[model samples]
Target: MNTPAPGPGTLAEQILRGVGGAENVESLTHCATRLRFQLHDGEKVDQAALDALDGVMGTVPQSGDRFQIVIGGAVANVHSKIMNLPSMSGGGTSRPQSDADVKAAVRARGRGRFAWLDNFFEYLSDSFRPLMGVLLGASLIIAIASVLDALGVVDFRAEDKSATWVFVDAMWRSVLYFLPIMVAYNAAKKLKIDPWVGAAVMAAVMTPNFTGMLAKDSGIPGITCTTNATLGTQECVARVFGLPMQLNDYGGQVFVPLLMVAVLALVYKGLQRVFPENVQLVFVPFFSMLIMIPVTAFLIGPLGIWAGNGLGEGMSWLNGNAPIVFAIVIPLLYPFLVPLGLHWPLNALMLQNISTLGYDFIQGPMGAWNFACFGATAGVLLLSIRHREKEMRQTATGALAAGLFGGISEPSLYGIHLRFKRIYPRMLVGCLVGGVIVGVLGGVNTEAFAFTSLLTIPVFSPTGVYVIAITAAFVTSMALVYFSDYRTPEERAQANAERDAAEAAEAAGAVGAAEAAARGEAAVTGDRETVAADDRELVAVGAAGAVAPAAAAAGADAAPTAGSAGEGFALAAPVAGRVIGLGEVEDPVFSSRALGEGVGIEPADGHVVAPADGELVTVADTGHAFGIRTADGIEVLIHVGIDTVQMRGEGFDVRVEAGRKVSAGDLLVEVDLDAVRAAGHPTVTLMTVLNTADVASVEPHAGQDVAAGAPVVTVRR
Candidate 1:
């Protein structure tokens, strides 16, 4: 019989179950290739099930809290699968809570569409996105252009003839002349502005007539004048009172347009403050045109040309003064360039100069390419093959091919490079090593108009040690990753199994001691019963004010000490909200209340803490409650309710943050019924952090009653 296919939720459950259930995952964030998880316990992982998933690419157990899962290009897709789980205490399931699970899940709160969107923006545009197209194009053009120029230069230089030289010179020069227009347009669009305006401005600056005029003996001073002719002599594109005067040629300059647009944006935004929206659009554009055009023409344009020239000249000087340093740094920064978007503007000058003067300065030395995509994918592929999980192995293999031949780099970045946090640093080191090889070779076979990978090596062309450098970089990175990586499946499992056996023996010895002593054994009850049967008991509200003792005589291992808040309603950190001011950890939200009115609420878990002082007014077993009257007088009413109450009991683990003076967004409970549902329960969740009687406006903003910690009624009196 054919095996049943795992649905998204089912697939998610299996993955979570294997990684020590919902308790294992510390927090989750997704990229294009895999789910970036901050996990607490990776040792108990069910590697076989994780390996079995169709989406998983490979696995790497990073040294930090992260457990990297290579899930192909469907990371976001799989994240959707995992998030659909009904939540329990602190993003956990219905399993009895552990302190580690509670503390860890606190990192997962405050994740919303906006937060995700912000991260998504960073994911796509910041470093890698803008130049990917240009990088590819540039690399290809460099190869092609070099060949064309070489054909003529070889013959001309060899025979001292003008014919071949003139033809090559004319064609090469023509493209260079038009190059500024392309850069300006592309840069403008990337900045979210009108491309046509940029193109028009660039075209005006680069016009031969303008160049011809500027070629005057000393230099033509800035005298803004208007000119319409596409081919005119000594004309200015912008005007000073309609007087036609000579001006500097600065077309194709990157920063000129950016400066103009930024100023225009400021004015436009300021106009919105004063004018109505309809007129704001018109007048803003009109005013921006009047202001920015002249400023750009007179000030920004000239400066940009000067700056670009200066930058190019500076780079030129560096190459001359310390060619070795230039070589070393270029490789160091090149790989980083693709990922950080800033590389486009910086590298534009190099490409421009290459177009102007045959072969880039790297033609002598000081050149190299980043082998990130190739090296990372190759490493991933090796891990995939070694993985016992079939689907994960297959995805990894495909991701590798994409990096090698298809020229896409995501597989390399998400699938391989980030497998271990340290790999990022290692890749940078390897890139530099390879860059030295190419930098020293400094012979030009191909010039990149765009960035690309190893297959483009021949384009760098027929012979050169630069080719060897590129190959060496890949080999070096792959080798490093391989060695720096973790043990394979069988090995890790065998080690774990062995350790478990040892632990079991020790436990047996302890048990034997207890048995012999007759009264040495502690009577076990529930999950923690094995630890301490005489545990201090506290309230565990089921649905109503109806409560059960959290544990019969359950004692906190580490109770409040000096400076720690004493137990009142015992806020027990409801739902694992990250505390700031009581600040600590990754990204703190708001600080303590020494100077403040209300405490900040940037909860890490999807649960809320009652301010420790509230009347347990009405609990409907639907998992919602209202608390009142604290020293702060904020009258906090926190309701742990999510969906249709299918997760009624599994919904919340409340300890109370009200009734006692509590700060904002405290962890009072742990709720991850979402995982409970994903673990095969129905999807109904207890919803709302509510308001019973009412207040004018909630001190906090209210939101949809979706999941626990989801905003319900933030009432204000």
Candidate 2:
């Protein structure tokens, strides 16, 4: 009685269709929440249709060269299919038509900020932007520092070290390190956000002398700064409670100060609700600082530092206890990095401690893992560069700089990882081969350098035995990259081949429809479409704006004419937004409270309207997201944003439970929008499809506003 949901690939194909098909696309990339792309002809896109998509979050014009589609978590899957979509010549490679267009593509950036925790990743991403500059500074400083220290001009020996060495090592070690924070600050500002406060917190956290203070290096205010018979004198103790802190004079403990600021922001938000705005600012920041600083310093900072140091110690212990097993871990993790970004910070943290840890076992993982992946990406880039397009070469060339030398993986990971999925096995083989060599030969860590390339391969080969193992990593990676049949030469013969193929196929399906389209295919900017759910039981959705009721679909008032509405579908509340976890729930699932694996909602008394108009699928609850399959086979996953799971149900209200059939206008859930707002969160509701491979099109129903019964999305065949 029900059809299976469309696969994620199907949804990608449909998205390509709406965007004038694969040939129309020039190139694509992704951020936290959107699929950023450049189309050969802006006129060919159906902006309204794309926005009206049921699973789509929204659309925005970003920078100068990009048109962005908000697709949330499904972005990666969709991006892959779009890239691999079939073209007339055989492969659908995005090709730009003009030099100016290529230049614009190189310069444009979208104004979206990822989650605060992802700041670590932002640091790495930003590394590529000023890659040459930052690397130059780091390489030159380290190189010069190494030279000076060797020449006896610089010393940190305390007994023999010069003031110059002390100053440079203590202060300059992390000089270009804050590059990540700076990048995020500039990027967020472009998004129109004031990040001065956040940046200030980061600056304090990264301050050279701050770590010492947190480590109890700065004289504890109340505790007497005295010579010790137990342990050592205050001046000699570099650790507190068996915890390590890398700093000169002490004072800046990052976590506590950051916590203070965050708590202060929370206080400001709370007071703004009742107290007058003018009075709240001073009091909020003032009290937040007053309450948080002492608490953080005396408690949080010490605890966090201890935990961090302990973690490092534990890893050290593990490596010391079992060297062989330790050697193989990196190769194993390299393959999984894309799916589970868990160890992303391990490299940075390893670097942070390397100054003291001396030789590291962790470096074993670094050898062939990313290098193999990087080699694979290099192959993809090289292939892209040689393909018959000059404009694409320019962009691919820039991307290769990061992929080849700097080891920033996005351009390679997203650009090549998907294109040559089969190359993964070879990459893994290479990694395992390297790991086996490390484990067998005892490849101890030298020291970590910032670069990840073939030239720097020896640093990883501490025993100077890298002739074969490291070479194996490169040869394997390159072979896989080159041999994997992601595309063929026949495919790159012409530009726009993919688009022409799709158009021709569609033309074959309905000549009459094609004629009608020819008559009305004029592109209209700012157009909107609204229609009722085709069925009584499914919901209809529109963008986040005032919706003209279905009665007005033909009333000539339906805004932005000539826009086509995709087929409709229905959705149900997954969980109450505020409820953190249901009974027996495990893993990260959507909460009714916030996004991640949660179903967020607007609470109040309201009908459970159809999310979009399609036949109902089971309203099963994983206690996270409400899983529903549209009639057209699109699987809709409506999740709330991150970390709302701990709320325990005070954050939101749930109206319709699972399996309640209703029309597009039927109220599904009247949410507690105010409660969520009061709790200080952007109520950006995301209704995404986990299985978007089969979905043909998504129509946006959410606009700048939402009244009752407003259509937010339309899915199509």
Candidate 3:
């Protein structure tokens, strides 16, 4: 019986074992082909074992205990499997000690050497990353409302709008107006405090009681208000308990919550230390609220408002005095900034600009970067379809949809552009072109904070110029990526070879199965003897001038008799290499004989020739493997280069098509060993017998180098 293929969960389990179990893994994330792991101790990992796993394409170890396991098209499944592992439950909550150790190690590694910088960015990322889904949802809502406004269905910005339009506006406003609470919750969670308490503190300031102070009939005698000359909006001060407190709208104010939560965590933690364990829950939260709420309203909130306004004013000055530079810099800077989470501060500035200036300019130029990103993904999608690259096609399709419709760039950025380095420079050029166009046309501005998507075109002033600029950016990037390609020439060639080999293998398998059915039918009809005779004759003809006389005689005489006691066959070496026992192969599938008994070969030459006269049964698209079936019922597999499927078929030349008859020693493929090695894969070629269970015994010869036509394995009854 054949060993069943490994299940996805089984593969994940094997990978976890290979990577020193869950304890060694600090955290894991995947992008396309590789599982990126930040490990607690990279030295503890068994690299060789990881590389040998059947589903894993290869292993790469980076600096600082970072490891990557390449899984090809099935990366998403593997990633999901790993995340769902029992040890990975609740986002590392189940294994607190292990998680704590990993985090400490990471901090210790960076301690005292700008480590705070890393922690600061991590804090920012964790705070905003969780809110991305809702943010996109709100942006798309704005896009829809803008679309209706553009068509004159209703005025989206009017204060006295239709009730229906007003309800639609509230749908998106629900997220933005409460954004501070959301940010507070996330920030507090990151700092290991009660998230609800942090949200409660931010919410207290936004309550109706605070806003009631703005009304002229307010009962509080100490309340005073003044109108601002710059914005023409009323600013109010409320005297509470003999102290003056500035009352400002807290909606959509990210800085206040982010700053407030940091202070809250310190107070909360200090209170926890003071209270006994039994009363900690009630007393700690109570003390935290008593301390933080007052501090936030009296100090941090006003300071945060000032900081945001100052930054917004500085950016506005740059935009006015140097419009062209501002426009160009915004688009170009965004590509790098967004990936690092540094862009959140700038995002906060955009909201501030809309509130104070009655319009925002940053998003107009930022559209160029977003469109350029989507365009590059589109180019990859087109290439995937053209080349029959199923995995890439799926990835690019989903990424493009998320970008174009939702104004979300994360999917495309992490899934594609980052994987292939060539895409960035080309995408940047598109950003530049779009920015220049906007600047030359006196720039684009939007009255409302809208996502820069096709649906939100109405939000921008001078819609025509915005449309032209974005179109140019999209077209330019798409054309560049399509023509030049995101992948290097070697990568492209390898991918093409893999596709061809897969098609050939599929075609060959169909033919082989049909032939096998016919032979089985002949045996049922008592024509076994004639069939056996024909098999010998066919083998002799195909192997003529290829095998030694003794080998040919053996094939003719040892042909399986009708209702034979056992099945047996021999495999000739397909390539000139130093032969090693199957047990010595790195890959577990072949080493365990899961695919059948095989011999590993360290190639001395690139040429791969047929080992026996037979019909080609399978051809791998990556130009890395081949399968053949002889008339005597012997099945053979010839694989070139270990983990080479990850290379897609680069540096391999296939000389013959699958399903074709070939004599022993026929040229099958030529591989470039140096190229394989350069691409970070092994050059060990393998030849295995797929039907080992049907055979009585398979004896493989080792301990010496073998020529292409050499009989390295013998199967017998």
Candidate 4:
């Protein structure tokens, strides 16, 4: 018996089951549209079952036992649902790390050539990803202030700004000024340490008592202050416990926390082992703060400051000397960097530049890349509208909105750009154009760290240059992608055919419902069974009565039709061959009856025909598969060969389009069996009833020689 199709309420449960019943899941997290899972056993995942779920858009299997399920805009809700499931109460929220599990996971992660590199990026990403909402919020506040400053409503830079303005400034400044503590907390959590201990250690230096010593007139003994000639910034040193301490402001410094947490995790875990579980929690955090606070203040603080400054200086020199090259490189590299999570370090640099150098040059050029990405999505959206590709249109619409308004490119990149190969090249061209414009115009700079978005335009200096450059990039990519088209000709045709068939099926369903209502029957739309028949009666599988097509259309009460009784309808063989059970089809999804019960045929020849009279519901672009819905609503799928889609239609001649009416034994495609075999694909043709659960029974007569149009399966309503 088939499992019932999942609805919205059961989507999370189905997804959990699909990924090996929560036990296999190590950890689950979500970005904008996908639920990312780190699983213990990737092999245990049932990709077919998840794909069959209604809410799940698609599934992606990645390296190192990772899986991603795309849920589009509803990802957050679905993720919440999964986490809230009763089965997930134990260890589903995160991986349960026993000694053996940890060792095995480490081995799996270390197997790849660039395993360390992957781990490094993942660490950086997790530390900053949770901070995006706050960061974006702060940036927008800065943008509003910048706009007000531009409009001369109030002098934002005035030393004696009003109390209200200062308070407003504090709203955004609080997030940036205390950013180190936040990063430290997140980083510690990522490393599986006590997060509060990390936050406290970093917070120690940011306190008023420590910063007060920086004032030369504070009258603290053994304290000294100096001014840097090059950067024109004050430096302070103080004596604590008879040792010199570097009393620098740790506010907005991200690198310090990142460095501190790495060292802290080791100390934390070692302490955990040394002390028993009863006393460990209190002593661990107590000792971690005691050791890490001084280490951070005396050594890590100054080192991190120096490191941030040195990197900032390098970028400053590049922008000063080779402005054009620097500008061009920022935009072009961002396209690649953003996908790999390598962009986080550059983002840290942006904050560092704003903190140390008073303004950042990286964001000016990076805007070009962002707008170009949005432009490509716009092109795809326009084409989806033109081609009437409903699913693509919806995807592109949401992705484009997220990009243009939120200044987020993940939706555009992951949802559309990555899937289609043709889009990236065009988007790159736009990035190059925008970068060139910024380079030629003396480059752009922003005093505040802001997302490259239209709302934040005023935050950047030389706004005209930034505006012109981004516009050129957007228009260039949009025009190029729109003109060239995102999909190939064959793909477009196939997509349109699928759309038409879906529409026809929907229309047929509506007619069936109306006919049932007219006959005073309680029309149960969900209970109706549809076969590989077009314009035939849509029977209610377990309902009291079934309606015939002719009688239903005429609004008349009719007796059982030819296909309504238990005697059933015969589905003829599409080709002359020796029939076999679905189990022998050599395809797991088919052999397991996941797509429904059917037969496989070792073809004697290449000619393929319609199994029954119906409208062709779907015709694969690669000419490897067909779906037919009979007049009595039996949806049959005829797949020509195993994995033959990889052949790219090289040896198959298709004779029918979707939505075309056909009869039993009608030629659907001409397949070259030898060519299929040479391409390393099986030549055995397989057929299945797609809506098998909707019918009373589907019985396949296999293990026999069959001629074309010979009855090979019997179906009952």
Candidate 5:
């Protein structure tokens, strides 16, 4: 029975069911290509069913009670729909609401003192993951401004500018300048609190009245200001009531908000319990903000700044003293870090560097990793084009565009790199080479937190060095992917065989449709079964006429060659059995000619022999299948039984090895048909001409019993 494919919503519903419905799910999140789940009971998940869903690419079970469903690029939409499902409305209620419950549910993978470190990284990852699209948009705007600056059209860095240019600057600066407020909101949301309250608290310190203290004439009493000789920036301090407080601009402060939100959540939740349920709505926000605002400005704000500066300075010191190690390590680490969402802390540090030190060094070496990722995708695209792999071609094209133009690596990393095991190692080599080059050239630096894309190349200093390094990285990975290929040799052959079979079926179908039209039947809307019957009859008549020519070519030598007389060759019976048509075979791989034109034989005896004179190419370790190549370029595969690989050499004994010459009637293997049947497998041995597509025609002889020496298939090349 044929089941219709499901839409995204239906597929999402199926995924929910496969994961043991909404009750088993404790929390859900999604990245570029995976729907990450924190399940209450991982054992309850029906992994096999989930992997077989219509839109699902694969499934991954992590060390914890965590599972990931790979949905390629449409993962975000799927995640949204899954969260909004009616069945998921009360999903959270099934599990406890405490922090311990949440931790116990998601923290199965880690234990001991270091476990908190994992949770901390996860908190940081969730806070910034949702901002990726906006971050990329802002970076592109910076790229455009840099391009204008390069062409002498505008001085993007100048404080004095026209209204139009100032408005243009605001396009990207809005995201970076008010970044602290954004981080606060996201951090609060991750902790299951009111996000707006966190945003408001952060915004209070950034207000115009609070910032006015920096001005000497307009500021209130007890305010002092000075200019730093080293950084060439203004610094201010204000004494409110009795305590002195350091005044900072607070623009683009990431760590401050992250720290403030943690405190706010505790205060806000405590207020919720103290106030009556009726007044909780109004009193919670009122009391929480009244207390936390002062606390953030005086305590959390300065502490976060100190912590961020310390981390940035440590990295800066490393870069200054040991530039080579720092350069190489940044690129090497990113490939591993990006996929797990663990790189957000480093990103926050980049923003901190720009706000404090006036420039960043990490983006320069990091560009090598980004381009190496894109280069690997380019390799996949090249190979897909050469092999006519349409699905892979489209995937590679989309991923490459996102990587090069938008400076997004998630699309390529999840859609292509993570899926292919061979790509990461080759890509790392590119990363290493590019890093070495950048380090030797004294490294590159940027004054803005620009994304590492082709358009943003001008943002980095010494554009020549940056370009050369990235170009070498891109070319190296691309060549490796193209030359070595992403799939193994056996996998490639199986894929090729499937493609050949599809093309052959399509050609045969078209011929059948044409013949039906010639017989005055309806061409476009005719009964397909009638056309198929006619095609089979034509094949049978053609087979009868080709036998005489095949025998003439054989010249009584048993194995026939096209050059001797006929158009191609003939394959003799490999074992004594009833001759069955290819259509009668139970396995679709043989019945549909997916592995090329073949015949099935229900063996009457245990003995098997060579069908034609050829050299052995493959002898299965399980004693099931053998591949032989003849002199006229005819390759044939003799398979002993259906689904017999599971027998593991139990019911059969091999008498030959690969790369050995053998004539027709050579002993190959001895099989026990009763033993194969008792093991719940078919004892039908199949003989297929593997290179049938390269020949003129292949015809199967069936419906009657035949001895081991009798002819059963004729091939014309």
Candidate 6:
């Protein structure tokens, strides 16, 4: 009694069921390759069923009732489907939380020794993540303007530029000039504080009244300006209430707002605690603004400015003295840093360099890393096309496009590079090659901060060097990944077999639907309704007709047996055992028949054999299960033991592979029952008809001792 198919429902319905229905899903979210669920009760999830799902690649159960279902490139589609289900209508994608829920969430977030480190990275990522669009937009504007400058159509750096070109400059400059305020707002929101308060405090310093004091001839009292000889930049100080306060331009200064918001959140939340709830909002923002504005202008602002400039100068010194070492280190470090969110500080330094030094040098070498990442994705795309892996091809195509055009690497990083271990080392070699070229040819610099993409190539100085470095990096990574192949040979074979089985199942479904339409029926055979036949025809004249000839040709040796009304088949015991009903099985999913009608066997020994002759459609990597599809379209699932997958093939010797034709009683695997028991897993062998609903009836002959290959289950189509 397999879990009865939810007829006519989409894959989302199946996923919802596998996650223990909508009621169990407290909140839902998705990333590149996985559907993240914060469940109300983790124990209710059907992990085995999810692993067996067609679209799902794997299931990861985390602490605090959190679950992640890996769906590869199709995650977004599957997530949309799940959210659109009628059962999910009561709430939005993320449900409202109660006091208990909040507490539980907090407890769940205690992710061991590095919890603070996790929170820190998450904070950094969220703060900058929202600004990516505007940043990319600004970078592209710079790219176009730089191209015109390079073509001699405009003197972009001239102080006497025409109004039209100056206006053009302002277009991209708007995003960078006010970046501090934007970062402040986002950082405040991430910390659960009043975002407007954070923005106001940072905006105060960038205001005309504040920046007007930077002028040496300003008539304002208690203000003085000086120019640094080394950096050739103006510095100002204002005497406010009989104290000297450093006055610095906060435009395009990300670190200032990042630091200011951290302090503001503390003050805002503290003010909230002091004031009554009704009057708290007004007073909290009031006090937060009052306290943080002065604090930022007098302390945090200068500190953040000095800190950013100090770091930028340090890197500049490294590039000046040892350009080769600096170039090599940056590209190599970025591949690891970006994934961990530790690269945000370096990104801030890049902006700081453009703002203070009027140019940035880091991005030139960094382009190597970006192109290398994209090149590896290209390799995957090529391999996917060769192997006919539709999912990988789709994923790699999108990731490569994002990388090359938008200069965004998260898609390539999370979607493909991280999943395959071999890609990183090969990509690193590309990074090294590109870095060396840039260093040996003299470092490239960009006046305007820009994303390292093909469109932004004009922004870098000495474009030839930059182009050559990136090309070398790209070609190296692409060749290495394509030649070596990402997946091991064994894994590749299994993946191809799974792909073939999925294709076959799709073809069978299409044929079934066409036949149903021909007979003027609205549904396919999957609806589980028996078809009415006219006279006792020797052969079934329907969708099954397509496979009847092959079944007949195989004759008595084949798995199926012709019945009076329809096609039928019998399944044998995979091991010498006493057959027991599914209800007696320890696993609830099987006991409830969610995976269809089946029987469990208490095996006397560990010699597992094939139950029928057909194509072995699926063989689990752990040797715990195998799916056989008969010539007459009977799908049988033979599972070795309860939770034996946890053993990871430690004591099981698998003798068969997927896509192979096997006869009844052919050796499938030899398991060590004692090893399974020692590992605290039950040794009951369960066999079920996965597609029982498609057949007429499936009967189990349980409660009897049976030898290997003895008939134990009967299926009728």
For residues 21-68, could you state the per-residue lDDT of candidate 3 as single tens digits? 777677888755668888777777775455435666555455567767
The order of the candidates by TM-score, greatest first, is 4, 3, 6, 5, 2, 1
Model 5: lDDT equals: 0.73
Candidate 3 lowest-lDDT run of ten: 543-552
Please give the distance, in angstroms, between residue 250's alpha carbon in candidate 2 and its true position after superposition.
10
Between candidates 4 and 6, which one is better according to TM-score? 4
RMSD of 2: 24.4
Task: lDDT for model 3, please.
Answer: 0.72
Worst 10 residues of 4 by lDDT: 542-551
lDDT digits (tens) for residues 272-363 of candidate 1: 57888777656755665566666666676666544543444456677668877776766675555433223333444555555655445442
Measured against the true structure, the TM-scores of the candidates, in listed sequence, are 0.36, 0.38, 0.52, 0.53, 0.49, 0.52
Pairs with steric clashes in candidate 6: 1-596, 1-597, 2-595, 2-596, 2-597, 3-594, 3-596
lDDT of each: 0.44, 0.45, 0.72, 0.74, 0.73, 0.74
Runs with alpha carbons beyond 4 Å of true place in candidate 1: 1-264, 296-305, 333-367, 372-427, 438-464, 478-717
Candidate 4 on 399-489: residue-level lDDT in tens?
Answer: 6765666577766775677666678789999999999999998999999766676767888889999999999999999999999998777
Candidate 2 lDDT tens digits, 248-282: 22132223333344444554356556577678656
Q: How many pairs collide in each candidate, listed in order?
A: 73, 90, 10, 15, 1, 7
